[model samples]
Target: MDGFDNLSASEKAEATELQRMIAVEQQKAQFQAQVHSFTDVCWDKCVDTPGSKLDYRTETCLVSCVERFIDTTLSITNRFTQMVQKGTQ
Candidate 1:
């Protein structure tokens, strides 16, 4: 904090912008991590192999994979809530 206070106006501004950039990069990294996790799960469920390019069947499977994963997440969440409520009562 004291070091930041010693910074010139321009340096402070640059630091602020750099902080913002770092925050954005952190968010991007988190998003990428989520995408990688989803891709890993979905790829196993969908993609059999990679040859030259993605085939129509694989593409369709990928789409279904994401949809089903989301659906499964929601379903589990709902059921978990219901189970908790039932237990509480």
Candidate 2:
């Protein structure tokens, strides 16, 4: 018998929905981890030392670093996607 055979239609639907929600949450967690990693790397490269207040120059460098990191990530992802698509074709 199937795992869900004992469930009513409504119950099965609810279980499926819950599974989808769990998958979504997992993806969100993974994305958060990637962002944290990016921030750590960018911080080391952009900031000279910790200060009580962020000076304008340091603030600008941090912002630019993050933007470039994001752009690089997107470019790599797009290239990988294209490669996968080409391989499948």
Candidate 2: residue 59 Cα off by (Å)? 1.1
Our model 2 lands, by Cα RMSD against the true structure, at 2.5
User: Which one wins on lDDT?
Assistant: 2
Winner by TM-score: 2
Per residue, candidate 1 scores C-alpha lDDT tens digits across 1-89 of: 54689889999999999999999999999878867887999888877877889999999989988888778878998999999999999
TM-score of each: 0.55, 0.79
Off by over 4 Å in 2: 1-8
Q: Report lDDT (Cα) of residue 46, candidate 1.
A: 76
1-89 per-residue lDDT for model 2 (tens digits): 54888899999999899999999999999999988987898789878989899889988888998888889989999999999999999
